[model samples]
Target: MSPKKRFEFAFPDIGEGLAEGKVLELKVQPGQRVKQGQTLAIVETDKVVADIPSPRDGTLVSFGVKEGEIIEVGRTLAVLELEEPDSGGGEAGMEEERSLVGNLETATSAELPPSREGREAAPAGPPVTAGTTAPGLGQPVAASPVARKLAARQGIDLAAVHGTGPGGRVLRKDIAETAENGRPPAAGRVQPLSTLRRALASNMERSNAIPSAVIHELVPVEELVALRRALNEGRGGEGQVPRLSYLPFFLKFAGLALREYPLLNAAYHPQRQEVEQFGEVNLGVAVDTEEGLAVPVIRRADGLSLPQLQAEVDRLAAAARGRTLRLEELRGGTFTLTNYGAFAGLYARPLILPPQVAILGLGRIHEQPVARGGAWAAVPHLPLSLVFDHRVLDGVYAARFLRRFMDLAARPQELLLL
Candidate 1:
């Protein structure tokens, strides 16, 4: 029998350009015997909350990261002690790695040397916590656990203080001195962006790269409003039929318009100089939640009946707000629709998401005075903002799409209802 080896499970690249995830929970602790495929920890990534599972059966030795710490891709997450077979077993059945999201790469005692001090060796590289960066350096700072705890308890950023201990590791005295020195107020200190904020910044930066154009229009929706109210009043109790919102009506209308003007429901591959258009309108509806803006896609938006559309919209909105939406629900959107009217915005200059050529923004519906048959009448008009990528289509094409959408919205009765 071979000596027991230590297995190091590093964080995996779970696709969708995930850089890091914040550990929401630790499911296992040292000395706990875990079976293969057991969940080790739960983490919050850019898109969803995920579980980091054990790749192979072993005894949990130590964790490279603690709960509430952020683990970057390629950094070790946990260490496990394993008994290896002498022959016919490839790296003690721990060579390959797998996770709930995707494949992962792991290292073991075969590649890494074990600690000579009679304890499990920690995974390579430091866990990149919230404030592990050095003052002027981008790398993680070397500090004792005691100092780290004291600094955190005192609300002192380790990166802003100079170390005085051996090997320049920040000590307890350094933290005490920094707190006693009275650093600048929180308003003036450097505030590192959270994981969600970082993802939003990256997306916004990419959005700014597209050559976008926005055109606004006001469409009368008195008839649509009356229809929605009647439908809502006639609906059954909870779990039978969902309450209707104007956004669902617009979602259906937008699908029809996208079918008529397929160019608007297309993706532009700039590197390949190609435009990929889809027959189905996979509409992405933007839902604002406490975490941030989440766009959940409704597959085949053009085919659903009014009730189905409303129910789906309600379900997706609820899931997004609760942060329980599946990965597939947040992907493969050919076009996006965002309703900012809930916030009382009349018209907004919404930005276009990358790859998708167009996005439709809906604004608050309000009464506008109009002249009808030599008489002044008030009509409810819904504001619309259509933003599109110039590289995929021009202003005229986008305007025509919006016109077709408004034509559908003009008569909501034409759409089939359950």
Candidate 2:
């Protein structure tokens, strides 16, 4: 018998620290011929549902994980048998090159590499720097640069002109307005927000309108950090050594606390005129992406172990950044968490997603002086912000939930019990 050649496919980092995900559906079966970048399966992460694509073109042998099963980041998702595995390898090379573009720009900037005599080296190219005002400065701008130039040739000022572009940015309509008025004033053009920006704007507006009362507390995270380091050391593989994050610990504690204080996990139902408490804890992990903010839910979080949680996070994050997430992956979140601390923010008042009564905001870890055995010492601490629906939960309940979470986070060992 001829020996079978085996090639392994591991999950790639899509972005947003998604560690693991639940396999929702498989598009290809074993022994099937598949092309590179072909959709293989649909995996749902905490923030979104993404289609897992084939890493290479080959004949599928078998799946490393099964449908409805959870998968970790960097774990083999599938195996393939290839006739010529290295064929069309240039595409992968291009992807690697694109990834380094940002670093190249940073390293090649004029400030980084000064010109001869250091006369503030000229720009690399055209005047594309943000906030540059060389154009239309000291001139009555009547429309877009092109429109303004056209109007100027015909002696038109855009100031007295009415705008037709969205948000009243000077457009062809403004020139028509100038002609109707027999005069044009200096008008300038404005750029409209992109689709992603518009989506974010709407979400922010909706979040602001929800009646929310925020409760804040401080949690000593010294033990949590220690646990993460221990896990990393014990795993001992390139990707097997999990990237330690405070999120898994937080999710564990939140799950236990939810059982004790169901009000935190309950959603307010306006149509039914009742409070609906969920039997399962589907926690949403907020992932910020180039497209916008996405929250993928980890279903039945209360039932998963710490290792399981970590793996799922890894997979989900990778899928999110890849933009292969599916629509179904974003549904059914009972509670939401926004870890703003990852970006160095002290704390943020995250708006609560509707129906879900509460949302948790995690802030940066800060070092503060503490008295240890009568001696002053510095300790790392995390700030916790909980915003809840004031109508459903009172201050006392909210405070108790925050206190429990803080206590559990301070002593992370207790979380393993639940």
Candidate 3:
């Protein structure tokens, strides 16, 4: 029998201070072959569902964890057996080769390197005698350019304020808080950003940096509400009675509008200097979680009927709350719609998720007096806020799109036809 080779695969730091995650689904079996970057499993952290990719190309020998199991950082995920054992030698031999490479590179370098004892050695370029300014002394104190400017603006004495950064350098947060509080600087408290918080912050920042604007419209949803009630009561005409919500109606209308104005169902790539108009409309529905907000997408929304849309919405929402949504389910959105009305918010400027060109926000639905057939009557009305990237879509195009949505939402029978 051939000797078994052990290749350990440890969990990597996926750009956030995520200490643990629950395995939602395992994609590979114990003996399956996996390539580098191939998704091995789906892990649900508090914030988002990320695909755990294989870091090495090999055959999976053993899986260290199971589905629905919670794992901590630095834990072994899987073990692999290399097809060729002698390709680069085993793990220990590979480490020795890496060390040899580092030594050779350092030996050939011009600059004096640090000692093997892991302590800073004396500078070898020139000798400094007593009474002469040392190499680092008399030189400007090491601080970030932003920190220096902040200190100058706040009239802060850097010498008095102890730096919490590397080599005792002051950071921006240290200066700002100190200047604002009008108190002596103290040791900085480093709180690592949670996985969800970091993802939320990054998404919000990106949305803010994108050129976006919101256009408001009032859509009378009397018929839409009636349709929803009928559907929920199993009285409506359909293949299967859908778990109804206002979202499917809104999505159907949005999808129809996308067919009319394809620009809204597209993404603007700033680097590529291109606007990609997707042939299919994939709508994202924003769901509020305890940690923050997350938008999971419904791929190919244009192809789904109202009942199908409702089913998908319910499934995705449940998956999101359960933290079982796949990474694929969270991606490939051409546009997004957030229903803040469920929580009783009137209207809000919802941030757009780039490179998607637009997002639709649904505000509180309430009974309001409306002029109908030359007489004032109480009607169910919803406030719609459409935010789109000004770079990719014009105000005129956005207005037209909202008008189409209003028409469909006001008389939902039109959506059945589309």
**TM-scores, one per candidate:** 0.74, 0.55, 0.61
**Candidate 3 lDDT (Cα, 0 to 1):** 0.71
lDDT (0 to 1) per candidate: 0.75, 0.68, 0.71
Candidate 2: tens digits of C-alpha lDDT, residues 221-282: 88888887887775746656566567887888898888889988888986786899989899
Worst 10 residues of 2 by lDDT: 110-119
Candidates 1 and 2 compared: the better one by TM-score is: 1
Candidate 1 Cα lDDT to native: 0.75
* Cα lDDT for residue 295, candidate 2: 78
Best by lDDT: 1
Among residues 3 or more apart in sequence or in different chains, the pairs in candidate 3 whose N, CA or C atoms overlap within 3 Å are: none
RMSD of each: 9.3, 19.0, 15.8
What lDDT score is found at residue 6 in candidate 2? 56
Off by over 4 Å in 1: 2-6, 66-68, 84-190, 236-240, 416-418
TM-score for candidate 1, residues paired by index: 0.74
Candidate 2 Cα errors over 4 Å, as ranges: 1-189, 234-236, 239-241
